[model samples]
Target chain A: MSANPEPRDPAGETLLSAAELEARLQQIGRERYHSLHPFHKLLHGGRLNRGQVQAWVLNRFYYQSRIPIKDATLLSRCEDLELRREWRKRIEEHDGWPAGAGRERNEGGIERWLVLAEAVGLPRDYVVSTEGLLPATRFAVDAYVHFVREKSLLEAVASSLTELFAPKIHEERIAGLLQHYPFANERTIAYFKRRLKEAPEDVKFGLAYVIREARTRAQQEQVLAAVRFKTDVLWAQLDALHHAYVEPGHVPPGAFVPEGPQEWQASA
Target chain B: MSANPEPRDPAGETLLSAAELEARLQQIGRERYHSLHPFHKLLHGGRLNRGQVQAWVLNRFYYQSRIPIKDATLLSRCEDLELRREWRKRIEEHDGWPAGAGRERNEGGIERWLVLAEAVGLPRDYVVSTEGLLPATRFAVDAYVHFVREKSLLEAVASSLTELFAPKIHEERIAGLLQHYPFANERTIAYFKRRLKEAPEDVKFGLAYVIREARTRAQQEQVLAAVRFKTDVLWAQLDALHHAYVEPGHVPPGAFVPEGPQEWQASA
Candidate 1:
C-alpha cells in the first residue's frame, strides 16, 4: 500500500563533528561488544568446563580461517593501491606466505589459532576440517564474508572497526585463561597475546578510514550499523555456543557434542 | 600433514533402499524442523503478546519475500526445461502472475503473508519496508538464496525438501491460530491455508527426484546433508528470534523490540 520509505534526512542537518563521531562509535563499542556476552564471561571467569572451552575453540577456528579470505575479497575490490598495500598485510598475517612467492615462510594467525585449538584439546586436523561447527556459526561467519563482498568498501572497513574494542577482551582473555585453565599458558594462549599486538594497527587503519570517509549522517549511520552488525556476528556465535553447549539439550544434530558433566569429568 | 579425508564408505555399505532413505529424511525433519523451536511453540500456543507476534510477522516477511527469488535462481540453473516448467509455477505461486497476463490476477503468497501480517496488527507498510528485521534473519534468509545459487543442482533441489515436512506445521499453525487467537478469520490466515494445498505436490516431485536420481550412497548422503542444512537454516532463524525476543534483554541494538510483560501486559 505504501512505498519503501526513502531514508529521510532532515531539512538541514550537518555532518557529525569528528570528536562527536568518535565518541558515538566508542559508545557503541562499549555497550554492544561481545566482551559483554555471558558466554565470554563464563570462559574468561573460568566457569566453563573443558569441553565447553573446546567447543568455543573448535567453532571459533572456522571464523579464524575465513578472515584472510574475507581480506582477500576486500583487496580484490579496492581501487587504491596504497590501501591495497596496507590491506594485503592482513591476508599474510592470517594466511602465511606459502613458502614460495618471493617471501620468507612464516606462521600466520590461522596457524596460531590451530595451535590454540590443539592446546585446548581439539585435534588440529579436526579444527581444520571444521566438521564440528555449530550450524549458526557457519551462517554467521559466512554472512560476514558475504557482507564484506557485497557491502560498500566503506562498510567493509567499518565492520572491522570492532577491532577498536578488541584489545581489552584480548587482554582479559589472556589473563583469565592463564590464571584459571590448565591447558592455557604463555604458549597455548599465544593467539590472544599476539592479537594485543595485531588488532591495534588494524583498528587504527579501519577507524581512521571510517571516520574520514563516513562524512554524511547517512554514511555515518551505515558505519554504525556495520559495527553493530559485526558485534551481532560475534555475539551470535557465542549465543550458538551457549545455547548448544552451556544450555542442555539444544544443540542441533551433527554439531560437536562436548563431553560435559557425564562423559568428560571437569578436568579444567 | 594429512589429506582432506575422503568421505569413507564402509567397505560393504550399499545404497539405501528408497524407503529407508525416506525414513531417514523424515527422522531428520522430526528432530530438526522449525516446528520444534520454542518460538514457534510460543507462537502457536498464543503465548506471545502483540509486539512479540508482530516481531515474528515482520522478520518472517523478509524470508517470504526472498522465496520466489531463490526459486527463480533454481529455475535459471536447471538445464532440464521440464524441471524449469514445473519450478516456474512456484515462482508464480509466490510472486503471482501480473494483471496483464492472460490469467486473471490472483494474490500470491507474499501478498497473502502481508495480509496475515496486517491481521496480526502490523501495518502493511511497516512489514513491507522490512526495516525492523533482525540482522540474523537477513543473514539466514540471504544464506538460503546463496545456498541455492552455489550448491550443485541436486543439492539445490534437495535443500527444498523441508517442504516435505511443512504441511503438518502449516496445519497445526492454522488450527492453533484459529483456536487461540482473536484475529482468527479464514481470510486473514489464508496464506497457511493455501500452502497446505501447494506443498504436497512440491514434496511429491522433489521426493521422487531425490529418490530416483540419488542412486549411490554418497549422493544420498549429500541429499541428507542438504535437508539437514535446510533444517538448520530454518532453525537458526528461530534460534535468533528466541535469543533476541524470548530471552529478556538480549535483543541487539537495532532489532524489533516487542511490547511484552511490562510494556504491553499479556493481552494475547
Candidate 2:
C-alpha cells in the first residue's frame, strides 16, 4: 500500500488522543466504507436480480476463503504470544476447528459461505475453484493477503480495523438478503450471522491494539492509511462486480456468467 | 495464481513439440489478451475521450514501473548463471543502463510511460506518485509482481510470454495514437516505439526458455497457464479502465478521474 505514501493529511494537529484517532478512523468508515458503494446499495435495496446476487456470492467467496490465510499471514509476522493467540482464533473461525477435541463439529465461516453459494444456485466446487472469479476479484483479494504479509504489523493489524465497521454490513446483509432473496433462509445466511457474533470481539482487540501501538502521528497515519487501503480492497471488488455484472455489463472472459434465472438450491 | 488447481485440461496428447506449444501460447494471446478488451479497442480505435486516455496512462504507470522489479525477482530465484545473464537484460532494458558504464542515460520504459501521461495533460510527478491510480490497477499490477516472486522460475518466465504478442499491439498503438489523438506525437508515444524494438529480443529469449524448460506435459500446462494468467492480469486492467472511465463510469474513489477535456501538454 505504501508503494505510494500519500502526502500527509493537512490537519496540523501534532499528536492524536486515542479518542481523536478513533474518530479519524471511524470518519474513514463513514465516508469511504464499502457500504457507500453503488453496488452495495443495489444489493441491499433489492435492486439486483438473482444473477447479480449469484455473481456477488461467487466472487465474494474468494475474499471469504482468504480470511484465514490472511489472518495466518498476520499471525506469522507477530512475535507477541498474546497477539498470536488472539489471531489464531481468526484462522480457526474461518477454517473451523478440527475433529474430536471433545466438541461439536464446526465447519467454519468458509463452509457457511459455500452454503450461501449453494443458495444462490452456484455449486460449491465452482465457487471454491474460483476459476469463475473476475481477475479483478483475484487481484483485489491477493493484494490484500499480500498486504498483510508485507506491511508493518501495525499496518497489518490496522487493515483488519475495517472489521470495526463490519458488523453493520453483516447486519444489513442479513436483513437485506432475507428481505430480497428467496434463498436467504437462516441456514444460507449463517455466515453473516456468525460474523455478527464474531467480529465485535475481534474488533475490540484490533482497535485497542492499533490505538495503543500507533504512539506517533506517523504511525497513526499509516494505521489510518491501512484502513483506507483495506477499504480500497473491499471497494475494488464491488467495482469489478458492478462493471462486470451491472451497468454496461461486460463479464470478462471466464468470469461467472450468471445463468438463466436462478432457483434456490439447498446445500447438501 | 494456482490457489485452486484447475482440473487439468483433458488433452490426452503426450508432450508437445516446440511448435505445438508455441501454438497453444499464441492461442491464449489471440483469445484472451488485452487487445481483445473493449477498452483497448476504444483506445486503439480512438473512441475514448482525452480524460479517459489520461486515466489509462496514469493507472498503467503502475504496471509500467514495476517491470524491472518483476524481472529482478525472477532473476533472484534463478540459479543458472546462463539464465541469470539472459534475464538480466530484462531488468536493464526496463531500468536502463547506468551512466558509469559509459552509455547515454536511458530513463527507461517507466519514464516513457510518464511522458505519455504528460502528453495527455498529467503531471509527471503525479503520475509517478501513483496517488491517483485506481486500486484495481494497483491490485492487478501487484498481483503480477507477486506471481513472479512466488511462482516457479519456469512459471515466472512463462508469464512474460505475453511479450510474444507485444509487437502487433505496439505497432497498432503507434499508428493508432498518431492517427487519431492530437496528443500522439513521436515524443509522447516513445514508449510504444521503444518497446517494439525491445520486445522481440526479450520474447525470443523468454519463449525459447519456456519451450525448452517445460520438459513434461504437466510442466507445459503450467507454462500455458502462466501465459493465461498474464493475459488476465492485463485484461483486468482494461476492465477496470472501462468500468471507471467508460460508459456509466463511476470512477472508484481514489482512482485517477479524467479531468476537463484534455489538451496535450508536451513533457518538459
Candidate 3:
C-alpha cells in the first residue's frame, strides 16, 4: 500500500517513479481531505442541531447534483476508448443506467441523497431546486465542474484521487450517523453506504491512470497540485457551512435559513 | 438604454425579442454584479488595510490570469471565423500580443495586475504563485472558466454580459483608488484604465450576439441564468474575502493572513 515512501531520486530535481508519485498523492489525501474538517466531525458526533444539519444537507445537495455532470465532462474529454469505457461507468453510477428490462430500482446517488433529504424533513422539491444553499456551495461545486472541463486529462483524472480517501469517510459517516441521529437508518444513509462500495473501485482506476500517465516531474507536480486543488474544493464548502451556520451566525443574504421546529422524531 | 421595460409577451408562453432580452440582461447586471458587493465598497473606498488590499490584488490575480484561458476555451468551441477573430482579441488583451511585432510596454492584464501587486508590496512571484489566496477565490474564478467552456454557445455568450457592466466599475475604481490609496497611480491602475476602453468594444459585440441569438423565452431564461450565475461567482469571492479579512475574522485555515503592519499613509 505504501507505494514508495520516498519519492525523490539521487539527482532530486527530476521525476519520481510511478509508485513514488502515488505515495505522494496518498500523502496529500491524508493531510488535506475534507474528512478531517471540523464540520464533518460535528455532523458525525451528533453535535449539530437539526437546523444546522439541514443546512449541511441542503448545501451538500448542490454538490451531489453536480457529480454526474462533472463525470460526463470527464468522459467527453477522454479520447481513448478504454478510458472512456471505464469513465462512462461513473456517469451511469451517479446517474443510474436504464433499469435492465427486468430490474425495478433504477435510482442513482442524487436520488438516494434526496431520500436522505426527505428523511431529514426537507421538501424534496426545495432540495432539488437548490434554492437557498450557501453561495459558497455553488461556487465550490461549480469550480469542481470547471476543473474537470479545463484541466489536462491526466490532471482531471488525478483530481478524482480524492476518492481514495472517501471510503473511510463513508465508513465513519455510516457508523456515526446511525448512532447519532435518529433519522439515520438503512434507507436514509444509503448514499454513503453505496459510496463505500463505489468509491474504492473508482479510486483504483483513477489512481492507476494518474500514476501511469504522470511520466515526468512536471506532470507529477501537476498531478499532486490537482489533488490538492480538489481537496480545497471540498474543504472550502465545509468552511462556508461552519462560518455561516455553526458560529457567529453570519449567513450571507438569501441563503437557506433552517425552517421547521428544532427537533424531529425518527421518520417512518 | 432601456431596450424594453417589459420582457413578457402577451401570450405569456414564449419568445422575447432581442431588445427585450438585452434589457433583461442589463437589468441582471444592474442588480447582481459584484460592483454591488460590500467588499468592493470597502476596497474602493480605501477601508481595507494593506494586507487586505494585498489579498484582493493577489486573489483577483487568479481571476485575471484565467481570463484568456476562458476566452481560448470559447474560441476553441466556436466554429465561426468572424466570431473567433473578434474573440481572439480578448485573449490577446489578457495575454499580451507577441513582442516587437510592434509596440513598447506591451503588457497583458496579468502583468498589469503584477504592477498593482508590486505597488501594493507583494512579491511578483508570490502573486503569480497564487499559493495563499482564499479557497473561495479559486472556486469562484474556476466556476467562470467552466461556465464558458461547458454551457451552450448562446449561454456562453450571454455569461460575458457581465462585461457590459464593467466599464462603469472600472471608471469608479480608477477615481476611487486614486483618491483613497497612496499606491494608486496611472501605471498601477492601468488594468482598470485599459478595461474602460476595451470592455465597451467587447460588450458591443457580446450584447448583440446574445440579444440576437436568444430568440426563445427558454433561451432568454438560460441567458439570464448564465449572467446571474456569473454574478454569484463574482460575489462569492468577495464574501470569502470579507468573512476572512474583515469583521469577525474567521480566516479559513491556510488562506493568506495579512503580514504587513496596519495602516499606510502614502508609501513614498
Highest DockQ, which number?
A: 2
Query: How far is A112's C-alpha from truth in model 3 (Å)?
Result: 2.3
**How close to the true structure is residue B1 of candidate 2, measured as C-alpha lDDT?**
50
lDDT of 1 by residue, A1-268 (tens): 9963533335344667667777888898888898998999999998988788999999899999999989999998999887899899898788766677687776888888888888777788888988978888998899999999999999998899888899999999988888778788777887888789989997888878887887678888899888888988988888888877887777766788865352323345
How well does candidate 1 score on lDDT at residue A232?
82
lDDT of 2 at B258: 68
C-alpha DockQ of every model: 0.44, 0.75, 0.38
Interface RMSD of 1: 1.7
**Runs of candidate 2 exceeding 4 Å displacement:** A1-13, A98-104, A262-268, B1-13, B98-105, B262-268
Output the worst ten-in-a-row residue range by lDDT, candidate 1 chain B.
B259-268
Q: Could you give the CAPRI-style class of model 2?
A: medium
TM-score, predicted candidate 3 vs. hidden true structure: 0.80
Model 1: docking quality category: acceptable
Candidate 1 runs further than 4 Å off: A1-13, A97-105, A211-218, A260-268, B1-20, B98-104, B212-217, B260-268
Task: Write one digit per residue (lDDT tens) for candidate 1, span B69-165.
Answer: 9999999899998889888889899987667757777699999999989877788987888877887788788889999999888889999999989
